[model samples]
Target chain A: MIVLVDYKAGNLTSVQLALAEVGHESVISSDPSVISAADRLVFPGVGAAGSAMEEVNRLGLAPVLKDFVATGKPFLGICVGCQIILDWSLEDGRTACLGLIPGGTEIFTPGPGSKVPHMGWNHVGFYRPHPLFEGIPDRSHFYYVHSYYPTPSDHADVLAESDYAGVRFAAILGRKNLAAVQFHVEKSGAHGLRLLKNFCAWDGGC
Target chain B: MLTKRVIVCLDVRNGKVTKGVKFAGNVDLGDPVEMGAQYYRDGVDELVFYDIMASAEKRPIDIAMVRAVARKVFIPFSVGGGIRNLEDMREVLLAGAEKVSVNSLAVQNPDIISQGARAFGKQCIVLGMDAKRSDAPGLPSGYEVYVQGGRKAMGIDAVDWARRAVSLGAGEICVNSIDADGTKSGYELKLTRLIADAVEVPVIASGGAGTPAHLVDVFREGRADAGLVASMVHYGTYSLPSIKSALATAGIPVRSVP
Candidate 1:
């Protein structure tokens, strides 16, 4: 069974429905036992990082998520869920993240002509091929709505890259048994659905 | 580059999508769920549904309708109209809409913007500003903010309200021109550019898109980050692909139809 962790951060309904669209059924669960029992974890979230972190800690999902990732079943993180897994984030007055990834998150300070929120459809340029990106073409456009992005310290950890505000940032990242994407696959139209479909079948290998 | 978005607006009334000329003499369209799914399949970047009469009626938005649309459409969609408080926004988001837009309630109580932003991430909060061209006194940019489905002018400057709402935590702004709505001539370029330049967040130009070229005009000359359409596609005048092709031919960056 696939479980979409509920951290009270953002709506997981679209994620669940998207999974259903791809012929995969999933449940939204914050309960540790249910999370641990699930075969895969789809961590999808949006909203403030600090508050999202607070909710995770409040729900005591940190360790369960950590232990689940160690099992190597299949885990995918989207948006805030992707950013929060990093070591730290500069948002919400410098919030410390789950530290699953190498580095921290920083705000987008792109030069003039670039919006602060950096909201819209942008290109995700894949740096290296992986099973999660199986059928998705390179440099595919995905819907993005975030002011900050994950900046992994190790370049090898980067799965895909996308640019905004004149600065290219890691748009997709991966470590052992876990994968993360900075865009909302559920909202990215057909390609987004295709990526979600791929993730559903991914075995967490590069 | 972050390509400009092409969003379709469905003015839903009593579960059916409706469109009118300048917010009057409405015509009933088909089901919101069916139309929303069709547009999604046709390659729209996003969708926005406004409950045309909910604010004046003083009731909650139709969650059943939202859920109905959510089940069929997989892309990002924002729901507006009749949203009163944080709970309304929460309900819509939980029902599967990506963002909850506030218009009348936002004008009546500005705090709802900040409150909604805090409760749901700013990314989930959209400020739906309905404005009309007015040379009225105290109105800057020659436009005044209108609420209650564009029936009442708030005497507040549209540009000022847009900037203020962003400061209070509006992730995005959808500027709809009442004068250009349903005209099928073109968008209100002056008003769209004014608000787009004022706010740092992405600004969507809503109302008055008759042809694909009209969208190109808004994206280029109006400096809009996105263009919102109602009549052109809803009435079967244009398809999403044709409109996107026009934008692409104009040398403006836009996502190709997949």
Candidate 2:
């Protein structure tokens, strides 16, 4: 069964329901054994990086997440859950993250006539071929609700890119057994559901 | 680039959608689940269900409807009305709604905004303000905040309240004009622009959405990030795709319909 890590972060329900829609039965858990034993891990989060990190550490699931990644298990993170895997985040005035990705996250300081939070649907341009994007079109629009985005040190880690306020950021990222998206795939429509189904069948070999 | 959002608002009273909403396949209408699924399939960026039931028993029925919609529809949708505190917000979100909007209760207790934002993150808290044109003393924008579903006017400046709500961590602001609600003549551009300019958060222009041209005006002139509609789509006056196509033709960036 797919194990969805529970760290008291939001969007767990939507993620679970989306998985169900894709014909997958997943269990939400913070238990170490359940998370580590599962074939795949779906880490979904919303809210500030500081508190989200605190919850991960509080539940003692941080180390478990690290070990799961190290084992080359299929894993995915969404939204802030995706951000927390980065080295650091500028949200809440700089919060330390899981450091799985070698870079940090920065808040969007858009030019004039740009709204912060970077909320709404925007196009995602694929940079590299991956199974996660099996049938999805290039530059397809997905729902986004975030003020900060990850700045991966290695450009090769970037799977897809999206522009906001003239600044193009990494909308989808992948490294070995892990894939994470800055957009809320659960909230996104058909394309999102397709992406989730692809991930469900992913074997951690990008 | 964040394209402008076209949202369909549904008013649910006692498990029944109170407005005109036709299902494409079925002849019968007013089913919230069918209408919501139809709108989502028609390319609406988002959906909002406002709980207007006054009875306690009907509240659970609304929650059930939210669950049903979440099961079939795969887009983001928000729930509002009768949400008094964080628990209520949690109930709606847990029931599968993405955001919980607070209007009259927010005006009564301002802390709920900050509290909800703190608990569920700012993205989940939406400030729904019903504003009316006012030239009363001390009213700067000539728009006063209205509460109790537009029955009572609080002398509070509309723009100021929006700013405060954002500062208190409101992720989005929905400015509904009491005067233009059902008139469909046009949106209250003045009020929409005032609040849209005041807050950095995304602002939705609601109340009067007569034609696709009105949405174009709000997106360009009013600077609204999103436009909310009910009567036009509900009454079958405009299909969701046609409205989006109109916005795109007018040179305004909008999500392409499916």
Compare the candidates by TM-score and give the number of the best one. 1
Per-residue C-alpha lDDT of model 1 across residues B1-258, encoded as one tens digit per residue = 899899999989988999899899999999999999999999899999999888878888999999988888988899999898888888999999999998878888999999998888788899999999888889868999998888888899999999999999999999999999889999999999999889888889988899988888998888888999988998888889998888888888998778
lDDT of 2 by residue, A1-206 (tens): 89989998867888899899999999999999999999999999898989999999998888899999999989999999889999999988788899888898988885557888898999899999999999998888899999999899999899999999778999988999999999999989999999999999999997
TM-score of chain B of each: 0.98, 0.93
**All models: lDDT?**
0.89, 0.88
lDDT of 1 at B75: 80
* TM-scores for candidates 1 onward, in order: 0.98, 0.96
Cα lDDT of model 2 by residue, B1-258, tens digit? 689999999887656677522211112238889999999999999999887654233243367778889998888999888886688888888888889998988998999999999999999999999898987988899999988767788999999999999999999999999888877888999899988888899999998898999999999889899999988988899999999888888888877765
Candidate 2 ranges with C-alpha deviation above 4 Å: B20-29, B55-61
Error of 2 at B177 (Å): 0.6
Docking class of 2: medium
Q: What is the Cα-based lDDT of residue A42 in candidate 1?
A: 93
